[model samples]
Target: MMKSSATHYGSIAQFFHWCTAILVLVAFMYGPGGPEHRVYSPVHEFDRRLHETLGLSVCALTFVRLLWRTIYTRPEVPPASRLMVAMATAVQWMLYLLLLALPMTAVIGAWLEGHSVTLVAGWEIPPLFATSHDVGGAIASIHKWLGDAIMWLAGLHAFAALFHHVILKDEVLITMLPSWLTMGRARTGR
Candidate 1:
């Protein structure tokens, strides 16, 4: 049995990473399947609320994840092409930015429209801007576009990770897996 040199991310980091990933995917898919996609009621307000709630959750999780990264040492890198490394780094930071910005802009837009931003029956965040439908609409537009951009970037990240795992035969993907899983795989000669 061989020891795993794959340094998995801390449990907290991994949890946040996967949680956010799933939530983001759900939000994206739910957007298109709105009221128009269903034969039942003309619209699914439930799905829209779910998407908004999850989007806000992502924002909160991202804040904690960023703080955790600042305090902890990230995994060491396996050697790769400079271009690949650079592209990966760029995608990572961009993901962080989009994750934080999307929810924030939504919240701001809501505020400008005189709507309270609430988290799943929790307390509401008070409006921070003057009521203005025009302003809210513009900000919401930016938020939507940014969400789409993040979705594309996430797809690229997944593809790149798979490429490293299958084609490059590197530790890139394993390093982000749970520690126990990575260790078990190494012991099994994977």
Candidate 2:
């Protein structure tokens, strides 16, 4: 059950997929910086903590997912047009790259700025340097820009999956759904 079968994703793969998706969404919502941030408020504090912890979790999960993926082949999706299949494959690759790159950039950016990633489990990652914030500003800028781009791409990925389900009337989306939900379902929505 841990390794994905030819027919559908295994439980572990599904778990990682959904968890990473949710974490990325939460992080994006709390990701804004500068003037948008309130210096001292519960919401702001919550945002900071959530972003830090969730980002870290995403990074860690991505590694596990990648390792699992490399060792195991993904489930065989139902037949679809070559174009659609290629599109899906490209989007997946982009997402995986983003999953790895974004968090690292953000983490290194924070470190360069002399800040610690206060992990939720009661540990803090120290800064990479003591007093050199020279590259922090640039890295921070890239982080924001790349973050926006990745969110847009994620939206497109979701839209494409829905397109395959609702418009194309395929199980491309269903196969990825949890077993309990996909039991008798043909596709997403009506």
Per-residue alpha-carbon lDDT of candidate 1 for residues 39-126, written as tens digits (9 for 90 to 100): 1133655555666788888998999988888877777777878997899999999999999998898788767767666554555678
> Which candidate achieves the best TM-score against the true structure?
2
What is the Å distance of residue 34 in model 2 from its true position? 2.5
The window of 10 residues in a row where model 2 has the poorest summed lDDT is 34-43
Cα-based TM-score, every candidate: 0.84, 0.86
Estimate candidate 1's RMSD in Å.
4.3
Give the winner by lDDT: 2
Task: Tell me the whole-model lDDT of each prediction, alpha carbons only.
Answer: 0.77, 0.79
For candidate 2, the TM-score is: 0.86
